[model samples]
Target: MNKKNLRNFLFTNTFFIVLFLGILMVISLFISSNILFKNIYDSTIQNSVHSISELYNENMKYFEYFSSKYQDIVSEILDELYKNYINNIPFSSNLTIENFRKIGIFKNVDYYIINKNGIIIETSYDKDLGLNLANRVPNYWKKLNEELNKNNKYIEGISYEIKTNNPRIYGYLRMEDGNIFEIGILIDERAIPNFPKTVSSLNLNFIKSIYTYNISFIPYSFEFPLLDEEDKNIFNSLEISKGEIKTYTLRENSNGKESYVYIKWVPDKVNNKEFNFTVLTKISIDLSSIVILKNSIIFIFIVLIFFVIFSLALYLNYMTNRIEKPIMKLINNIESGKVDADAETNILEIDTLIKYYSHLVNTLVEKLKEEERDYLELKEKLQMIEKEKDLLYEMALKDDLTKLFNKKGSVQIIQKLVLNKESFSVIYLDIDNYNNILEKLGQNEANDAILSLVEIMKTIFRDRDFIFRVDENEFLILLRFVNLSIAQKILKRFVDALKKFNITSDKPYKISVSYGIIEYKGQNIEDLYNEARNKMEMMKMKKLELLKKLSDVNAEEN
Candidate 1:
């Protein structure tokens, strides 16, 4: 399977149209030549058969007239004799043969009165008087009898008598007296008329002129005229079947000369028997006279056909390119993924199609842009919503003032550590005397101290460690993947950092915090937190007792 694009296909087929036309012209010429030759062959056969049929009909008509006229004459004479003489005359009265002879019934013919036994009892020719029809011409009489039996009327046909060797048209009438009255007329050379030989000669000349050949009519079982052994062989090769009416034409090669031979069978009658003859014609075309003329005509016709086809091809190319150029441009636009150009055409349907296509492309472009814009806008909206949600989540987890994780955040971290069974420690820290400081200074100063403490704690701890404000005055830190020593170190560092940090207040007093530490190893979060808070309360109480001891010593010294 060869693949071709539209432009290549159009250009290639434009030239092929000329080739197609040439083939068609050749086929038509062949068919027309065959038809013309067939007509000539058919006409020749028809004329030959027609002439023979006409001659046969003329002979039959003459025979019918001769036999019917004499039969009526004999019937009337017999009827008159039976009515006036044979019927009224006495039985002793004799109806002599001279009576029939005198009436001229036997003047140029033979007459016989045959009895039921086919015995000829009376005859105009005395020599045939004692001959029986059965012994002499039995089949002929039997045929006659069969014909007569059909209609019981007079019947006649041409037959020959075996004894006399006389070819005669014989008619017989069976009379009421149980006798058959028969009449026979000798058939001479003029009996069957011959068609004019000049007509045959003229027909031969006509056939020669048209077919450029020679013809010969050969009677069946007769010697052919001066044919060579090869010619005889050629004729013998054409085996004409019996009873075939249609003429046959064959192509023959004789002495290296190609010829067309036509054979036809012509039937004729001899003594009531049908026989066939053949008319064979061998036609060899002499192309010398018409060859130049035929070639010239063919050349002119071919040139004309080529010129017409060439012009048509040119017009087709023009039209195909006209349509293809615009379509190609439109295809290019589609393939390039953009519609920056449009196609123009003069043809109305093409123009309409281009316009509709251009509109469709433009609409599709606009729709695609709209879809992209909508997608981008939706993406932006989703991003903005995601950012707002993140801010809200941060606000929910962190304290508003210190921006540290609240009690809920502390619980979340502790639950995560417990679920993971992490090795970590929780250190619960509280600002000591935070209520006293809030009463002494202002709420704003107290909040500033807490924020100041949160910054100090962030500096002492690593980012991985969790630090979150649990309440107003309390905070918790989770150190992950650490032991008791790491927890103590982290708590001591936080306490030391708090001692040096001063509060930003009018009094400018330092803030102190109590710390409680415990190692966390997948412990219940609530129980671990409560135990650490209890330890912080015990530390606070020990510090207060030591401060009271210092105060009593100072009072004694004063």
Candidate 2:
């Protein structure tokens, strides 16, 4: 080879080898340091999270105990209050509720008179007005009904008001007419000093440990005080986008202080199983010493590697020991300050696979959510169509004037009953003096009388029984699972209610009703209905004849 060409080739090869070797060493060291830091950081966070969870569990015990005690005292007080009032007042058709209403207005006292159907027939508070508890809270309502059958003294723990969500103490008692009397009072009215008021945040100082910790109670809806209004709003929106998260701890850095931020839930097991509250605990642990030790070890290794690079031909073994010795010592924790581990080549590979898999899983989750949204939208549309169909069906069945079932609805009900072959009785009533009343009081007053009669029938009959206005001043009632005797008893009750209405009313004339009942015993519905109507006609004739006799006797006496 020529001298000039040989010299140029050697120089080019040596330059490349040195440059590439230096780059490889720097990269290897950098990767190793990062791996070491991650392991130590992960370990420290895991230990802090465990400690925070333990402390939070210990803290909830005190709150639970106080909650039980508070409920006990309130239950006893409300129990006695209900006992005294229910016994003294009693239930009556003519009972004046004005005094009770006045008391309800002044005090935060709520009272409900519920019928056998679990409907609130009358209530002091608007929240309970017309409420059907049987459909809403069946278990609790069933328990109340059971108690009514037994001792009629049922008291329960604290619960939120249905509409207000304000805590209330409640009790129930049995009343006449198969009705239930329920009473509720605001909890604040009964609360005394030293009552456990829900707090937002607390700064507790541990005198023995010389540690000051900040524990904050998080409401379902909350705002952090440290953030400005605009930033707070942005963060809250982001939090919502992240969805609801609970019962976890993670490392957080704020205002130069490092801490384990814990989110926990404390349930009110003693009072209500469905009730629970959230707490956020931040425990700061000093990590400065660990950081310092880790940095110092890293610095020593970095210096040793450079020394190895400069003296590789002569003192390679010596430089390698220098680098290895310090790392080996650091592998053992420094006064429990620093955590270390042997670097793994697979750490980076595993992390990359995890990120790629997470992206795929997230994409799948979004697709599933979109499918769920479509399902819900379709379900809502179907429900709306179903509701519209129901409304149209109801309009067809209901009477225009009195809001009772008409002829068409009555025919449907009878045909169904006959098809099923269930025992039932038909009762027909005709207003004997409907024409006379129309002539005397005009059409409006006559309509008022008919409405009054309908109300009386409704008050007397069970809700399960059906009442139909067949024609003007002519009404029909169909009672299922009832014999002719039961139908007669119901008619008697209607007479009693009508009598009360006439006595209390300020109308110009008294109201009267005539009824005829026939039990269906495998007979034609037309024949039975005709028989009931004929019987009513006969009763009307007999009354007219008696009136004529009375008139003649009065004429003779005069």
Tens digit of per-residue lDDT, candidate 2, span 426-452: 888988777888999999888888888
Those runs of model 2 whose alpha carbons end farther than 4 Å from true positions after fitting are 1-356, 545-558
- Candidate 2 collision pairs: none
Candidate 1 residue-wise lDDT, 85-116, digit = tens: 33545311124334555433232455677888
- lDDT for model 1: 0.62
Stretches of candidate 1 off by over 4 Å are: 1-358, 502-507, 555-558
Residue 246, model 1, lDDT: 48
| 10 residues in a row with least lDDT, candidate 1 | 212-221
> Best lDDT goes to which candidate?
1
**RMSD after Cα superposition, model 2:** 28.4
Global Cα lDDT for candidate 2: 0.61
TM-scores, all candidates, are 0.36, 0.35
lDDT of residue 394 for candidate 1: 92
